[model samples]
Target chain A: MTSAPVYLVDDDEAVRSAFSLLLGTYGISIETFGDPAAFLARAPKLKPGVLVLDLRMPAITGLQLHERLAAIGCDWPTIICTGHGDVHACRRAFKAGVVDFLTKPIDEQVLVEALQQACAALDMRAERAEAAHLVAQLTEREREVLDMVGRGWSTREIAESLHLSPRTVDTHRANIAQKLGTTSVAEFARLALIGKAP
Target chain B: MIAAPSFEPASPRMPRRLAFLRSSAALAGGWLLLVAAFGLYAAETHRRALEQEVSESGRALQRAISQRVAQHDAHLTSLSALGLAQAQPSADFDLVARSILRFYPRIVAIDLVRLGPGGGVVSSARAAGGTTADPAAVSAAVKNLAAGRAVYGADARPGHYRLMKRMNDTMAVSLDIDGRGLVEEDELPGWARLDLSSAEGPLLEIGARQAVPPFAARTVEFAAPIASETQPLRLSLHRTVTLSQLVPPLPLALFAALSLAALVLVRSLLAHRREAALARAAAEAASRREALRQHETKLAHALRVNSMGEMASGIAHELTQPLTALLSQSQAGRRIAATGGLAGSPVDEVLAANVLQAKRAADILVRLRAYVGKSAGEAGMHDLRTSVSDIAALSRIDLGRRGIALDLDLPEAPVAARVDPVEIEQVIHNLIRNAADAVEETGRGDGRVVVTLTRAAEGAVITVGDNGAGIPPDILPRLFEPFFSGKPEGMGLGLSLCESIVERFDGGISAENGPSGGALFTVRLPAAGAIDEAKEAVQ
Candidate 1:
């Protein structure tokens, strides 16, 4: 799989440039913006990325930007950085669903580690979205068969409950396996849970 | 900060001086009036005594003159009886007449005359140096003579008078008497004039006439008639009273001296009382000035503390950006080196960037130091105990109003340090205010702020602690950093400014959780003598 994209937003040009250069040495390419407004304007069109945002910005703080993005359903993994880190701000960032909080002169290793973690969380969310999308394409009868199977129901019980013959239940199960690419009950149960998540 | 109280002493000096002069003048006037009254009374008494003496002397002299005139009548009677008994001109009558004349010196001549057809001297006698009697005087005396009545005629010569008595109608006796013999010379005082006069005019005058001055106060005159019926003489005595006698010099001098002394004594007492009042006013003014000076000192300290917070916060915000850039750049350089990047490649550019950022941050710090640092004031030796306690006392009222209790624990002996007193007070006040805020945050009724001053081997130590929640261990390390605040609305530079001011004076400050689980801040400053010793050692 391709590496996750990274975006950095900060008001200070020098700080943004320095952070971009530092992270570039570790083979992480960063797209930088001088203000939150610029980053917010391009946020919806951009691909899913790890957002490196400065907490204190001119019109919009990192937390506020995070909230605005979440309102528009652009829930990208975010890491917050501040020149002056306070506990209250840290707690607020965490409560706002930011992936990590860092203070400036941020340790390069620590930033890289936090970025790696955020990338892993993005990958996990992408896999979950892909599973949910695949589940959305299944037929209504197949969904019902899948739901029962996930509940640990037997084919005979499911056929009896649905007023279907055992051969037809077998046919619907085969269609479910072909569409989901997972015939294991545990994989079916995980896919069912993923589809059920809000 | 509190405004100074107003106190102005009324100016009583001019009015008091006027009052003193008024009272003194009144006293002096009253004294003079009393002296004048006494002088008049004494002069009146002297005048009365002098009049009494003159009248008594005049009466005595008049009685003596009357008796002398009556003796002439007796001489005339004896001469007439001798002539009448003889019945004719006989040598025996002549002999008796001459004897009468010789016996009475005032009786200068004696005569017995017959009247009606031809009245001639039947018997006559003359003194040895007496003037001869005039026939017209004899005739006039015979016409006026009455039975058993002696009549005095006018002056025969200059000072002689005649007295006649009629035995019968035709036979009468007459005698010539000298009026000058009626009075003695030494009977009158030198200041008096005495004159004896008959019905016609003045007879004889005795005593020298007194010269009356124009301004004489009074004149005394005594006049009386002689006792004898024949010779009705008037005796008059005159005396003039002078101004000097009315008011004597000796008593006036004494009274003037007494009044002056009394005035001087009263004036001195008034002056003493005025001086005491002035001294009291001066003392009050001095105390007021000192109170005003203290109030100004407190106000200055409050202003310095507030401005220091503002300046420090601004500097902190400005310095943060460059410091962040420096950290990132250096880390970038380190990463490139660890990856074995070529030294002459991007490493040089990264290193140059790091140096640039470092220099930028250092320049910002230099500007901040100049803004709120050592140039603000000079340090001086001060007792930490007094300095801490003074600020504590000033804040106590405000703390008390907010339902907080502040306690002080200062050593009895002085803890001296070389630091600016105003700067030190500012630090103490800031810490106390922070402690009060912390205690108030707990919302406990029994909020207490304790300030303690003590001397340690290192230096003078001052500790300010509160009975509130202790500082969290996580934030303790960053507590003194500029713009790092636990409070929401704080500029977050009070503690940092305190550190700067304290460190400028060669002092150190630390924060810890006390035994009671409350935040405690301790400041240590080098003692004045200790600093001197260190300087000597360094030299």
Candidate 2:
């Protein structure tokens, strides 16, 4: 698995650099931007990373940036960090797909945990995309066979359930492994669990 | 030395008090006039009534006197008839005189005389008592005898009179009547009288001799002929009626006294009403002023608290940046030191930067405390320049947020004044905030507020001027009045409270249009040294 850097966007240079240093001590890489405008200018080149945004800035607010990003279909995972959070602002952050909203002088443990959670959620989304692609390649009989095998059923049981011969079920299983590029049963079970586009 | 005239404003209650006094005086005067008029009318009415009663009594007395005299005349006529029909003896005449005198109290004597050949009286009635007949009397008797008539006269004595009738050409009969008895019959208590007149001017006068003024005493006169038809003897009765007889004096005096007392009562009642109204108005004014004072205090406190809240948030924002910087630098430096990859200069630099940022955060907290923290507010000498600078520093964050520039024009030397430092700072802060608001309202770019402190004869003057559209003409008068606001969000007590605080320090505050444009507010406070000197002089 590849780890991505966290992007920190804030109007205050001190806050941006401080957050970069704080997060860097925990072995997390950070990219700092002085304002939402500068961050947006570099947004296209950004890889899948967590966005740590300050709620208030000079040109535009963090929430407004989130709205812009949503309008542009930039669905990067987000963690909102700010000095103040009224209920309205918190609601807007959640609506903007933020994983966590933290107020400053932030607790280091809480920030690290929120980052880990955001990155994990991003990883899960990427895994779900891969699983759906692999599942789309399978034939209908291959899908039924994969589902049954992932359930820890025997080949004969899978064949009876599908009303097919055991030999046919084995061939379908082999074809599913080749199509998914994973011959490991554990990998197949993982794919079968999240392969329904959820 | 020529001195300018100082005009002191009249008190508000003056006109009403004056009007009350005028009306009260007029009412009192009118009351006295009414009493006097009624008293005069009562006295006149009483006197007239008394005069009418006295006149009636006088007429009745005249009738009684005539009746008594007529009875005496009848006796005299009988004596004359006996003398004329047959020569009567002296004893017969004497008997008749005694009988006449007994019958008429008015008559005291009677006489019979003979006029021999020449109408000379040869009279014998108790020897005539040396009352000789005059030749005129003899001729009058002969003339009366020729006419067959009787005569009466009053020239005999002080209170006596005589009546006679011709018995024949040779004789006549006579009687002398006392007039004093007539006075007794007619005289009443509290009244005077005069009796009949004969040859004498007046037969009798009774009562006091001194004349009474006409209106003060009521007089009645009655005149009636008495006795014989040939004698024009008249009974005259004079009755002078005094006021005490006509009307009792006590009730009239009581009525006058009561009227005067009632006048006093009505006047005092009106005066009391006026006083009560004045007192009520004064109390209402005082109460209204007190309520206004309370409302102003509440609004000022609320504005101060709310602004402090907003400043606190700004402080959080302001301090957070430095805190964040300090945290990040120290953390970065620590990580580098733990890794053994820290270059000496770089690590030291980061730590130094961290220290600097931490100090910056601390400085922000101190400023925040100075701006919003409560203090003992002990009045003492304060450096005006320092207060202005402190307020300027406190207001910088708000000015920056609003994109306004604050210009300070304070003197290099300290301007010392006597005031509570916090309160004075707050007043300056309020003025700055108002200036910023005025600038903000203009919506002009690069809004500027200039704060200047200067020394004046009376005190130190702190002026806050803003480059904005000047205050409107209509609201200028009410600018320092409580609850008068130009902004929709303004509590409007800022300037009013500032004025009050300044005045509490023996100072004043005023606003005016700057020579250029915009609004300028000036606060004046007494110099601390000058106040001390004044105190010393008073001591």
User: Candidate 1, residues B1-539: lDDT per residue as tens digits?
Assistant: 22223346544364443364447567677667867777878888888888888788777877787777777766667767776777788898888777767776667777777765565767677885566555555666667656666677787377777777777776777777776666655655677777777888877776666677888887888998888777787888887778787677787778778767876776776677677777888778778667656865765665565466446544655566667777777778777776785565677667767756665665565466445443445778888876776677677767989999988888878888998887788888889999999999999999999998888987898999999998989778667766778899987678877876786676778899999988999999987777676555434
lDDT of 2 by residue, A94-195 (tens): 755678897655545677888889899888988898899889888887887888888889999988888989998889988998999988888889899998
The positional error of residue B448 in candidate 1, measured at the CA in angstroms, is 35
In order of appearance, the predictions have TM-scores of 0.37, 0.42
Best by DockQ: 2
The per-model lDDT (C-alpha) reads 0.76, 0.70
Task: Indicate the residue-level lDDT of B84 in model 2.
Answer: 70
Q: What is the interface RMSD of each candidate, in Å?
A: 12.0, 15.7
Clashes of 2: 1
Error of 1 at B348 (Å): 50
Docking level for model 1: incorrect
Off by over 4 Å in 1: A1-198, B1-42, B73-83, B88-104, B214-218, B248-539
Error at B190, model 2, angstroms: 8.2
